[model samples]
Target: MSTRLQSTNIPSIHVVIPGIESLKTSLESISHDTKFEHEKDMMFFRQRGKILIDAMFDYHPIHLMALFLNPRTRKMKQCTNSQRQSCLEYIKQEMIMFDAFDSDTQS
Candidate 1:
């Protein structure tokens, strides 16, 4: 497990996010010898990873905007129409708020 997470790069989100479903499937299919001393711990890890990946499907719109705007995920095939709209609105509101702040600071 330590070997699996040795590398971290933000740009890898483009590759990782798109393959989450397949990774979840692989996690769900994991099986170890029942007699192993740490079998239960291994199973727990698999279950927890699956749960987190599944929850990513319906994550907050703002959280998803990063995926949507990423060059490698611009198609946003994973997101529903409503999620896209929510992200758009969220960005617009944030832009307006930031503009107001910028003007205030300038004054």
Candidate 2:
């Protein structure tokens, strides 16, 4: 009788967040395998990125914003009705520049 031993190599992916809790949370959210096929999961990450972008604009935290907006993170999806309304209010309050641009262009 002959015996064979098999070995498998798994590559590691690192996402570095500033705090340990955040790092742990991020790790918990993702899979080790690259094949994350769920469309809803992908959309969630994208929405998260948009939220981070908005936070950055409000707080002026460029690095955190950049990390969130990274293409590797994910593409954003349409927000739910409540989230959309909240975001609209936030934009009106904090993103007057964008609103002004829209208004000027429409005239």
Candidate 3:
């Protein structure tokens, strides 16, 4: 007789929120998982850093606005909400651009 694994037993998908601690942990995990002599992974890491730096500069204004209107401040919820929306829109545009670049490379 064959047995089946239940979907509930499987791990659910999770979206990691971008934060300094989370980013550090993620980089450490990636480094640990990469085996020795993995030049490709090293190169990929460098490329990823470049992309991140580029995105940082591209989104600097949005990020500055978010920081300036941080939720931790008293009664800044509205500013925080606007900043969050701007961030989401910026990320969406970046994703679309990345997808287009990927398609062009694949072709």
Candidate 4:
């Protein structure tokens, strides 16, 4: 991860968002794991999974914006229409602030 960050000219939000979604999906799919020999261990695993999933959902706006900005993911094929709209609005707001900052700098 450090190597990739150093290699990129800018922060790679586009790449990070997809990788996060992939991990979240994988954890969501884990209904059962026979490798766990005891119920307590299984419970612990599920609890941790739930925490991670909640964290991912909490930061979903960041993920959504990254997806919307990425050319390859701009279509947001995996997202609902409402989510796409939310991202669009977020971007518009950011751009407005940026424009204002640019104008201020010119003075």
Compute each candidate's TM-score over C-alphas.
Answer: 0.54, 0.22, 0.31, 0.57
Of 2 and 3, which scores higher on lDDT? 3
lDDT of 2 at 19: 32
Q: Global lDDT for candidate 3?
A: 0.48
Worst 10 residues of 3 by lDDT: 12-21
Steric collisions counted per model: 0, 2, 0, 0
Model 2 misplaced stretches (Cα beyond 4 Å): 1-60, 74-96
By summed lDDT, which 10 consecutive residues of candidate 2 come out lowest? 1-10
TM-score sort, best first: 4, 1, 3, 2
Q: What is candidate 3's CA lDDT for residue 97?
A: 100
Candidate 3 positional error at 86, Å:
0.4
On residues 24-107, what C-alpha lDDT tens digit does candidate 3 reach at each position?
Answer: 345445445445788677768866875675466333544434443445422323234665567567767877999999999999
Cα lDDT for residue 88, candidate 2: 49
What is the per-residue lDDT of model 1 for residues 15-91, given as tens digits with 9 covering 90 to 100?
44446645776888856557788878888999998888787664655556776777767777766788678878888
- Tens digits of lDDT, candidate 4, 16-57: 555655655665564465766685666677669868776665
Pairs with steric clashes in candidate 4: none
lDDT, each prediction: 0.69, 0.43, 0.48, 0.71
Q: In model 1, which range of ten residues has the least summed lDDT?
A: 1-10
Name the runs in model 1 displaced over 4 angstroms.
1-7, 11-58
